[model samples]
Target: MDWLGLLAFGDTGWGDELLYGLGITLGLSLATFPIAILLSFLIHWAKASKHRPVRIAAHAYTTVFKTLPEILTLLILYYQSQAVVNWLTGWIVPGSSLSVSPFLAGLIALSLVISAYGSEVVRAALNAIGKGQTEAAQSLGLSPFNTFRKVILPQLWRHAIPGFGNLWVILLKDTSLVSIIALSDLVHVATLAINTTREPFFFYLVIGAIYIVLVVLSTRLQKTLEQRASKGITRMEVSDA
Candidate 1:
């Protein structure tokens, strides 16, 4: 079958399966992103804390995750988490076994890796916020929380945008790694299609094309966000004339 026909719908083609796989891929990324962002901020704050224990713990978290290979992290978390779940199930309800969903497992694994890097981004952004601003806000009778919400966060976001955008692209591509655990993600589905259709080149190429499109769109979206975030900030320009 031609590439177009192979990707066409209506019972004979693998189009539906691929579409479903795409949905799962997007869902996983979307679910992981917000969790990663929240964790990044928390980690950044912990690392910045005056208490030695908090800083030590936060540093250890980032050091461990950033040092480990993502695939290894995923494998360890997936199997270890399942082992814990199984142990609990055996004790709680004899003869009944429970398992972690691949979706949730993949999310947890990816979030750990992404947020490790994101923490650095957040830390840099927070540092970029001048100490004077905090003092100024406090002088205006604003509480720490209000100062962060109104004054610190806005500037931090602008500085963080570029780093977050880069991480977003990496995270999107990293979703393919979930295919290793038989999650039926885009790459996994493509592999199945290739085996069934006996057209490895075509199916793999299709997967590549889909990923390229996603990267392009993500990059464009990132640029849009940077522009929006940097609104009212001065930008340097070179004169051609």
Candidate 2:
């Protein structure tokens, strides 16, 4: 099909739904990224806690999540949510049905998965800081909290950005797994288009194109962030108290 035919909105084509799905995918990924990053930072702090119990708890969380299969985690959430929604509404909500809403289920699942990996990235980034830096800050009389906020966080972010960026792209792609939940996301839409039109190649190719564009643009943006993060070194000037 020609460019016009490829994009036309009708039984013949799916230009409009594709564009809308693209927006949903981008919005979902970006929205969840911040949540994942915040959760990751907290987990990182928990992992780095001075108290042995806190540290052990944090260690167990990351270890457990990292070992989980993604589908199993999501399925557990999906079924639990299904029960809750039906109980609250007094109507068996369709999430437990053969067709669930892919969007929210996928979001919850991918966020959990990304947060798992993101926490590790964050912990490593913070650990990469020379221990002497914090001690030097303490010697100069900055409080523990202030030291982390001013001296440690700035440097830690620079190191974590690259890893976070890569993970963001991966999570964005992982959004496709939501199809099992039945949301009409891009992949689900493509499946519909292919099944109905009997043109698997055409729809699949279109899906690939959309995903490639998103990943490439994201990769380029991350490269810019990587450059910015690398250029300035955070050095704390501490004088003996």
TM-scores, each model vs. reference: 0.93, 0.84
Q: CA lDDT, every prediction?
A: 0.91, 0.79
For candidate 1, give the lDDT of residue 40. 95
lDDT of 2 by residue, 55-91 (tens): 9987887787688887777788788877666666555
Best by lDDT: 1
Q: Candidate 1: what lDDT?
A: 0.91
Lowest-sum lDDT 10-residue window in model 1 = 232-241
How far off is residue 153 in model 2, in Å?
1.3
Taking the tens digit of each residue's C-alpha lDDT, what string does model 1 give over 1-241?
Answer: 6778889877788899999999999999999998999999999889989999999999999999999999899899999999999999999999888999888999999999999999999988877887999999999999999999999998899999999988888888999999998999999999998888899999899889999999999999989988988765744333322
